[model samples]
Target chain A: MAGYQDLVLRVNLTTGKVATESLNKEWARDFLGGKGLGIKYLYEEVGPGVEALSPENKLIFMTGPFTGTIVPCSGKLGIITKSPLNGYILDCSIGGSAAVEIKRAGYDAVIVEGKSDYPVYLLIEDGQVELKEAGDYWGLCCHDTEEKLKKVYGDDYSVLSIGPAGENLVAYACITSDLYRQAGRGGVGAVMGSKMLKAVVVKGTGAVRAADAKKLMDVTYNAYKNDLLTDTNLWAYTDGTPMIVELSQTTGILPTRNFQQGTFDQFANIKSEAVAAAREAKKGCVSCGLGCGNFTRVGEAVVEGPEYETLSIAGSNCGINDLGAIVKFNANCDAFGLDTISAGGTIAFAMEMTEKGIYDFGIRFGDADKYVELPELIAKREGLGAELALGAKKLAEKYGGIEFAMQVKGLEFPGYDPRGAWGMGLAYATAPRGACHMSAWPVADEAYGEGNPFTIEGKAEMVKDLQHYNAAKFSLILCDFWALSFDIMAEMLSALLGEEVTAQSLEQAGERIFNLARLFNTREGLSAKDDVLPARIHRHPLATGSTEGKTLPEEEFIKMLLEYYSIRGWDNNGVPSGEKLQELGLR
Target chain B: MIIIELRGPLARYGCEHGEKGRIEAKADNGVTVRQILNQVPIPLQHVGLIVVNGKKGSLQTMLSEGDSVVIFPVVAGG
Candidate 1:
């Protein structure tokens, strides 16, 4: 454990136990860390048949060897647990000081198990751990709770906390970090809440020692320089992802009005220019070279993101085009600790339900002024928000509007309208995390020529390859944004770990994680049937947008799934076969 | 004559936002996005996305009048 401290901190809330364990080196080598290691621990500790929100579930927080190092965008952490929404393996990564602080606190990972008899929060400082009473903090939103913790602790302590949404166990609740960053999707926060843990406050002044500091710095600096020169990447860093509003709208892939159409004419209202114009300031993650996070000021309020997904789902998808409202919604999701994508998706489903006469509300598209009240109601799980909190899959199931749920595997689709870009649809269907856009963003190819997005010419190959690559990047705790190319990542890995990890090796590591996740899902009874997109994307053709009249044919989906499974060495039903498991050393 | 629109950083050198301006060129050798960039004296490589008529295209994509083109840089991460 030269690069790693070989330590994992374990907390049993029920018994008020705080202990440390040596790293399982064999598992470490095979699974790596972050997502890979987290999943390994989760699979071993929690049975698949256990209810996601039950006391039997465990939440594992992890950081990779590269985390806290000079590796660019290595400041990321993964919160792994069983998902209440998808009922499958859930691992969500987020940027902030949390992962770096955790690593510096002298542990590569932290596993919290069993429910506490009372509300509590974990505090860690240089390996010292404590379970503090959280009775006064239980019902507060994430922003207030974070502020209260910072006041009691210190501003330097990195905090991860949940809001009423998680405490209420809203299926799509997210864990909030560093004000606006989130380990969003799959109800990680709800799992945390179920354990009666309000937050994890961490402060660490320790440093991450690379095997070769000089090499690591040189490689990291080289990446920083390269990223500065990348055009699209520069845009992302400057305007944030919301800069894609115009592009997505123009392409008709913005997922408007809950996938009723892909394009929105009011996209200009939420474009990056509008957002940047409204911004009061900007910021980014710890040690991040590019400062991309936008903090906008409209009236007296401040907010983050409205990023592409939030703007699409909350704005165009719900027909609320006002940038101010979208920004406010994003901030609400952060303060209240909700996943903006899921929140937006759920709200959009409700709007569509209202439109179709299945349900009635005065809601209409582009009515940003009115939607402002929705998040507050949703966070408290009151009125229509209560039903919306059930998540799009459950809502659609209840309301007989399943065709327009715009979800896959029970998780709602993100901002990208899959109708225009077919690779994204495939990516969503096969993503281990369920309907996640980042698992593989093939739209970069189809939309911008990073690869061939439309042809499906090499899509099966591209999708499988990218999925593993993303998993590896996540494991290494690097931002998938800055790890744009494999060559750069291989250099970073080799430099930091003093190992010659080639692009092929990195891809192999990603494959290992992917298959391990599939095994977890299989053990949970998920099958090829669980891997699917909403009917709108596969059955009903869109009448407008760049992909007008184009729907991903079901046969193509089946073919792509088959190719993807085969590429990953999985069985015909998308489960990891025994030989494949052994190949990844997971067996 | 053909026109294209620049966005984000690339918009700094452009005449207008979403405005169309024609560049004279031969039919078969119609000015590519690259040639247009050369004439405009802007850094084309800084562009992360080039959409021609709402389809993801590149600088190698030839320009044509009546084509609503938008060139942008990368703007978001996971």
Candidate 2:
């Protein structure tokens, strides 16, 4: 417990009560922190059958042991809740100083439950906590709200605020912090809105104490110099995520035209070089040395990024090649606190439905003029926005075209077209939060690395190992950009916590956390049937590019899924076995 | 002569002639892709993907005259 804050803050908005309790040390030992710890809390506290956007739901904010320390890229705050979009467990990591601020304020986690009668925001300054009326800031955009809060609380305070997308209860609404950083998936902001809470502001003056400062510093400095600053990790600083646009393009996984094609002819117009051409500045999250954030400006639009996901999902997938339009769309989404992936995916699905004569939303692919205006509409839930706000899953259910809806578990797919990367399809289908690229990116090894992109052979084990690795890595709250191995992670944790941590133990913890999440999903009525890709992926082959004439055959996908389940010690139904749970100490 | 293309940050290892990201290498009929890579100053560990004539290739892949090769660094992001 040397690295932990050893405290949990509980707030009841309806009754206007605030209290602090000791963190469960046993759970901390098993879950580590961040995503793992937060999910464990959610699984235990928020039982099954609770509606996501109701007062019965709970929102938990958590930070890892590495947070507030000298650990590099350790400033991620995990927001765990039931997703209003899909009624599933959702945990989103947001990069900013909020995690550090929360840890410095002497707590490992903050849990908010029940609903407030009026609009309010939780303000925490060291030992002091208050729920202040936020009626004045209710209707403001995320950027303006943060600015207003900073002006009132001084610049030292970090604010996490939701825009109109959350206030209006958009299913894919996101929570924005530090203006551009967001917990951007699965209606986390809607959960906040459902609680009638607008923002959480914090200022902490205390410092985190490392168990063995000398050893921790030495190990961290060594990794920072030898591993992090090397060519393997330097791409984040030189090009950031925009560099991946070309990688995904070359691998035939660019996800063009609502994933109907694997390649985009206009990819050059929105690639990393294009972003670099319009780049005005570079930014990074707290304690970050890589500084992967690219602050771009085109025409009058400015935003921290149209990161690779935004570029591929909103730009090429929508058939809009105009970088300026994508930049404006990115700014709009950031201002309105929308998940750009879901927004773009929903619009792209509509475009395809209209083109195919299934339904007409008066939008077409490559309509950049109309595309840029959608975030405001969707946030306000007006006219076309009302339909778009329902997200891709609901839209497909309402109209026809469920085959091309391009979502898994009601969450929209990210930039990768899984047909090109077979292992990536498995990663998406089995991801706990649904279609989440962050869960496990097998594309790196298959499409982007030396491994064959179009094969299922050896893919099951690869995906399983990668998922476990990412689970542990995110629990430590390190940036995914680091690409450091498990050995490095174990060394750092061992030094920081004064415990004999090993790569094997960390992996076991990851497996435990992953299984616990699966159990939570099973208890909520999800089974192997829920873990599936859309018909477009299984039935339709991409028409052109390196992946031309390729489809992840349904039979092949089933084989891969069974193999993955077996590897994870799960039953054929994708439920963790009693023995497996006991092995991970879950039972 | 075989044409070699570098992408993204690997463009720094491009040859002196042709374009900024392109290189022309004289390769024997039996030369492996590893041999051609060894002839350049590019870091082998940093190479994530190797494409030969638009198809995925490996270090053991044999090279021939007029072959086109593209090399890129490991790509990872969320």
Candidate 3:
């Protein structure tokens, strides 16, 4: 495959050795790339229940065949590892130039294993690879660290670095790149921190060799570009995700007051219209056309988002609808290298705990004056920040109020409240990296799907198809916004690999990846019980908004899961049978 | 008079008519949202959700005087 460099860079930090190996063509064909190939590597080398931050585990940095090519929205870097926040096999896909830089640097994936005795950072320029001492750059925040690297390596280098949160081993820490873009979930940053690796800087002057450059460019410009320029995409381009503030608000799914309700009365104050006024600049990721990132000004600090998830969790859910405050809060998290979703969800949990008299951090819902001070403490594991740094699951475990912790499998949910869209409920439950919307965004179709968004019937099917499609696309690693249809993915993959791989085959590959992730978890003692939603979602019916008085019936939801499991060739316990594995060639 | 607030690109139609987003138009009490949308210059496909007074309503939903309609596009986010 011309698109794939067919090289895997193996770095042993402890041994201080680096080796370049030929790509496993068979695994590449079976697993595809990105998350798919990512899991294949992680699954093979790491033991079933290996400690997440252990040197025994490998951090696989992967890029797809479309990466570094003319493919729109293709600069996706997949960070695959056992999560320090949760025990699931996690693949956090981040957008930026790093993936493209990695691909152009002559490697499909870079598997970094073994812990370093001292802090170091890996630098890759074309084929030249070296592990340089990073002690001087260790404690800098994400933004400052990137600036320091850019000063030394020049602007051409694409740096993926961590910050104080990672250095301090914040459980929900994330890896930052391209300034604000991140592999933001599942504590992948902590994994990097544990390895004593500060950053992976790549400078690629070489062009990615695509299978058929003309065909790839033609299809990219003609089909994907034409469709993306339409009105729907125009909205994304203009407002980015700040528009979701209104959509979620007007539809009564804004995730307000610790998720006790779905509507936030103050939504207008923090919505797209408000954010647009504060927008100092629009940021685009690598090869991105839909560029939805907002670099908005708040006070003297100019920060990227406090996007939908941050706005919802830290804004509405925390009972603070001040957009500027949210922006500052967002900047603090990015500097501290915390996952904004997890950090915001954690604060919301603490507020609810204070309300319930379970614990007091002097926080309250509809009031977040204290949150601005929490991120730094959380990153440093200082004072109450230490307890709160454990995340919602562990906090709720120790202090009580587990019912409203707003987390699944130790991962916090995004802004979408599931009562309004039932498919999201299933998506949250079944996500391999815990309650992640990226696993598959059924909420998109469900919110826009025909008839009632409240319908239970066909939600399972919609979630299933999306999971498979996204799973496959994750390896091709196209952004969901880019993968509007499978035809585009199939055509591009075929053109890139110079093979006639259809969307059908690609989706099949996705199913294989999903199953493999499940297998990794099951091997680590995952059960059907793990495939369950938070009790708050099932029991607490929304008291206000579009989904007022709606909640998932627990037994019915289980039945739906059973149907989904059966559809996916799994048994009652949500385990994929041997025949299914054989079918995917995973056997 | 029925008040309809247009969002995203759907605002373009109202903008062309010298109305900024929120357009006031007369419609019979029982007219479907589809009918009102058809009367507007906007391409109906661009409108994903038709929220009537803060609730998700379908195109076939009946519209009435004093009822506010907010139309949004079917775009996605992370």
Candidate number achieving the greatest lDDT relative to the actual structure? 2
lDDT tens digits by residue: candidate 3, A1-587 = 68888899999999999999999999989898999999998999898778888889889999988888887878788889998866779999888789988888889999999999999999999899999999999888899999999999899899999988898888889999989888888899999999999999998777778778788888878866577777777676777777788778766678887789999888888988899899988877878887778889989767777578888888998899788788888989988899988998988998988988878878888665778878899999999899888999999899889889888899988988887878788888898889898887776667643545676788778888888888888898787665367777888778877889887888789889999999998888888988888888889999886678988778778878888888889989988999999998878
Task: List, residue by residue over A1-587, the lDDT tens digit for candidate 1.
Answer: 54576899999998999999999987877677889889888888888789988888889999898877776667889889988876789999878889999988999999998899999999999879999999999999898999999999889999999999899898888998898888888889899988989999998888777778898888778778876446556565667777777777766677888888878877777887788788777787887766678888776567766677788887888888677777777777787888888888888887888878887756666667667777777878998788878988887777688888888888889888776777888899988878998788888766654554445567778888778888887887777667467788788778777878788777888888888888888888988888888878778877786668878887887888788788777788888878887877777
Instruction: Report chain A TM-scores, every model.
Output: 0.97, 0.99, 0.98
What is the Cα-based lDDT of residue A464 in candidate 3? 85
TM-score of chain A of 1: 0.97
* Residues B13-54 of candidate 3: C-alpha lDDT, one tens digit per residue: 664357777777676769888887777678766678777887
Native contact recovery (fnat) for each candidate is: 0.46, 0.46, 0.49
Local distance difference test, per candidate? 0.80, 0.90, 0.84
* lDDT-sorted candidate list, best first: 2, 3, 1
Question: Where does model 1 sit among the CAPRI classes?
Answer: acceptable
**Highest-DockQ candidate:** 3
Clashes of each: 10, 0, 1
Q: Which ten residues in a row have the lowest lDDT in candidate 3 chain A?
A: A444-453
Q: Write the per-residue lDDT of candidate 2 for residues B1-78, one digit (tens) a residue.
A: 888888766777775554777878777667887887787788888887788886677788888888988777776656
Candidate 2 fraction of reference contacts recovered: 0.46
Alpha carbon deviation, residue A31, candidate 2 (Å): 0.1
Of 1 and 2, which scores higher on lDDT? 2
Error of 1 at A264 (Å): 0.5
